[model samples]
Target: MYAMPNNDLEEATPWLDSGEQQVWRRWLVATAQLYRYLDEGLRPHGIDLAEYDVLVHLSEAEDHRLRMGELAGQVHLSRSRLTHTVSRMESQGVVLRRTASHDRRGVVAVLTDEGMALIESVAAHHVRAVRRAFIDAIGRKDLMVIDRSMAAVIAATDPASGPPDH
Candidate 1:
């Protein structure tokens, strides 16, 4: 239980009410737990959640390639972080970076055959993990509600509908 702050209009800005606080707290906890659970499930395959996300995005790209900047946005990673992650993946023969054909100044990350193979190998297990941890836990009805709710949040936050961070 929380004591409501005295509404001294001149003294403080608006703050979350008890109901809003409860929702926010639960959102944070659920996200953290979901990521941890997925990461752990991928550990046996030698990839963390973020890395898996990178591969998944690359796999869906045209010719399995995307500009460095584009890939960063797709994976919700900072430019420098994507560079470092791609560098490591390059050394592992999973991906390679090259100058973009359309823009010499732009770098493009291309998924290698090895990377494709790796993703294929882990796809089934990953799907199962996702189902076990999230989909199955939330039945279809609830999942649909969550989907629409999340879309609303995104639209409200991003009125322009510009490129997303993820």
Candidate 2:
């Protein structure tokens, strides 16, 4: 059997050079700032980005409901994390968790009427914020490139091709 070398860790280093590092650092900063801006925009609606994502996903789901496991996977949250979040939202009348009729072992999370109303009321503001921070800032030509690049990133990070969730 071959033995591992002392320099094994060095082989794991990113391939980025100095210029790539500069570009990557800028991208990281921009990503954080953008998230902060969006979170700030959601403050008035009493929702943060993660909760908003849950709301949006549920709202778009069939009958505004999904299995807890499905919801967690769709929202990219851990099962325990989704349970905690759903519990809080349930207390706020934003959503409800119920036992599945067909499967005793399954739990379903459904957006409540009040939750639907809240999201509907706040959606316009969220859309406007997105437009202001992103769409409005980028030129149409650049936006196309950005869109394509984002799609490529998503494709690359998809479960089948990429490493497990980071």
Candidate 3:
């Protein structure tokens, strides 16, 4: 149970009703289960979801590289966490870190040959997992609804309604 500190709530506060609470709970459960399935699927490749995400983002970038700050934004990771992840990948020769040419103090992450190979090996399985767990389980109409719903939620929550970090 999440413990809320005992504080007098004299002012009005938004709260979910029972139905809304149930929906939130179910969403949480489903998301957790899906994450676990995907994480397990990638474990044999010696990378977790976060690391794989970093790899994918880097691989898809122009010249297969991106600045650390840009990568953090694309992966939804804090700068510090991205630094640590990149450091580990660098040590494994899966990624190369270079000082930015324009800003010597800044760093860029480039996918090495090994990193590309690793992603190539894992991509097929990852796609299958995604398809089996999500797309295959939903009807075409429901999938459309899910996509639209997610887009709407993101538009509502994101500070910039523009394109997401890609």
Candidate 4:
């Protein structure tokens, strides 16, 4: 193997200040832990957070259906990944896909009665998990702070979206 090259460019890095670094590391670990904690609660439901999110969007959609492309964007998943996830859910009889009525070229994912009932059943559990893992942990007084901070981050990161509609 060739020896690694040392360069001044590599040493000229700009790093976070100590306070920011502490918060950044904590935020990283906390997010991972929170996600895993919530996902564990959904384990018996046979779906992870991503699948649950899909179920929720489909359930809230008009006539319980949304075009695949829209679903992918809403869920922050790439089209191919959403297709794969929906395929699996289809096999599990939770969702079904059909060509869009208004747009023949587009496909729509529809939530079945089983899916509706499943989400309704799990919603309470998910809410409890959210409360325990996030809201309660952060406390009510700081909740707005967290929300505002996230909104600012979103505004900065996703200028197209602006403030959250929801």
Query: Which candidate achieves the best lDDT against the true structure?
Result: 4
Span of ten consecutive residues with least summed lDDT in model 1: 2-11
Expressed as tens digits, the lDDT of each residue in 58-111 for candidate 3 is 999999999999999999999999999889888888999999989999899999
- Across 73-105, the per-residue lDDT of candidate 1 in tens digits comes to 889899999888999888889899999998899
The TM-score between candidate 3 and the true structure equals 0.86
Candidate 3 Cα outliers beyond 4 Å, as residue runs: 1-11, 160-166
Deviation from truth (RMSD, Å), model 4: 5.6
Q: Write the candidate numbers in order of decreasing TM-score.
A: 4, 1, 3, 2
- Residue pairs of candidate 3 with colliding backbone atoms: none
lDDT of 3 at 82: 91
Q: What does candidate 2's lDDT look like per residue over 1-166, in tens digits?
A: 1234457665664457778878789879988988899888888888888788899999999999999999999999999999998988898899999999899999999999999998999899999988888888887898999899889888988888968542
Backbone clashes in candidate 1 total 0
* TM-score-best of 1 and 2: 1
Q: Which stretches of candidate 4 lie over 4 Å from their true place?
A: 1-14, 159-166
- Least well predicted 10-residue stretch by lDDT in candidate 4: 1-10
My TM-score estimates for the predictions, one after another, are 0.87, 0.85, 0.86, 0.87
Predicted candidate 4 versus true structure: per-residue lDDT over 1-166, tens digit per residue: 2234367654554557678888988989999999899888998999989899999999999999999999999999999999999998999899999999888999999999999999999999999999988999899889999999998887777957666442
lDDT comparison, 1 vs 2, better candidate: 1
